[model samples]
Target: MFVHLTSAANAPRIRRSGIRAAGRGVRGVHCFPVLPSYTLTHQWVRELARFGTRGGLVAVHFRLDDAEPVTVRHYGTPGERTTAAEAAGRLAAMEDPRGWEVFLPRSVAAPEVHRLRRPPQVAGWRYFPGAHGRRPCQCDGCRVRGEYGGRRLRERLPHPLDGPPPPTRVLLARLAAAGDPGDSAVLLDLLHWFGLRRRRRGPVAELARLAGHPDPQVRRRLVETVWRWSSPGAAELLDRLADDPHAQVREAVADAREWLAETD
Candidate 1:
């Protein structure tokens, strides 16, 4: 989420300028002011993207120094047809001296899943944002167990019909066996969870292989996951990844090295 926090003294002037700019009757323009040291949280970013769908430009002015202030302009476009290349070009043109950046929301194309038009005998899995409890068993193995355990116990359970989704575990195994870059983001999240769980098998080896993935994002995530795990040979592998051509990969490797050193 992006917050606009300007100094009280400059707020009036910024507001007046904003009003005058609005009066100009621009087809697609939105303007606001943000302060230094302000954070743009993930939730707010999602909200901003949702609110800025009117296919216009929104400017975010910021105070960088007493004499020079920075201005960032955000352009919101309609529909899901905008390409990343186009968005990058638009961002490049709005280069503001005051550390301004432009953001465009891009749609993610996910794999299609075929679901029955009518509900099946057994309901499929559904993910809730923050729900946690003793849900009903839904996995193949868990469903069998539930059948033997009795319907009364299953009905009284506080959890959903499906047990905890093990997409991470299943995907990690697939990545390890197949090395599919398509599952990189899911693998990264799984690796992070694995690191936290202190699991030293399966996904760790897959993540190690991904250190050399062609996708920079995948390689970067691998570096972070490896470092977070702090597995025995992770540092040595990261040393080679540190020299990766992609800036994101290099940065992740450097951060991992620093974290390792601090821990040691």
Candidate 2:
């Protein structure tokens, strides 16, 4: 289970568990504040120890990415510092003085203690929500920006993008054109819709025909779409993309080729 320090009251609960804070602002190190027991329980620390016992590492990630503290600023008393995983591993080894510090990202919010199921990557994670601010922020012209409709300044930005792609036939026809550079823009938009349905094999032959389109952007999109399709012809199409003029397209082709080589 993931716990969210959404308010000032909850922040101390996390701190009392032996978590400490260092550095200024959100850029410093913070601990997950979990303690271990030999036996397992529903409690988060016991859960963390159980996970760490299985060769997983634990770390406390914050919700906000910036230097500002979304909840209570101070975490706990000063102590030996290291990342959550490192601390969890040390504790799991049955070491004394069970505590360590985790470095908070300078500009990214990562707010959770999750199991690193895979080696070198914290793959499995649970996210917690922070409480909304009661009043408008005053720092760095935040209030002024809000007065002018800061985040939502654009009228139709959300509605249109969240909605559907315009039309398929129109986009496909525009993409089929021989050498018109301007048509590539329309195709790029269409790719967004098609890209989402990557699980389904759709119109592979028509897309493959444009593999040699002069515009590298269109060809890049084609390479991505072809990678998703599990068609028998996918290998041959990707082979052609291997020699694409654009460095990016060739890189995508290299990835696809490696995937095929591994899967086959």
Off by over 4 Å in 1: 1-171, 177-186, 195-203
Q: Which stretches of candidate 2 lie over 4 Å from their true place?
A: 1-159, 166-170, 176-182, 259-264
lDDT of 1: 0.42
Per-residue lDDT over 111-199 for candidate 2, one digit per residue giving the tens place of the 0 to 100 score: 33332212222222211112123433333312232343435533323333443454657657756663444467776766666675535
Q: What's the TM-score of each model vs. the native?
A: 0.34, 0.39
lDDT against the true structure, per candidate, is 0.42, 0.47
Task: Please report the candidate that would top TM-score against the real structure.
Answer: 2
Cα distance off (Å), candidate 1, residue 38: 20
lDDT of 1 by residue, 87-133 (tens): 33333444331223322221111111111111121221122212235
Error of 1 at 136 (Å): 27
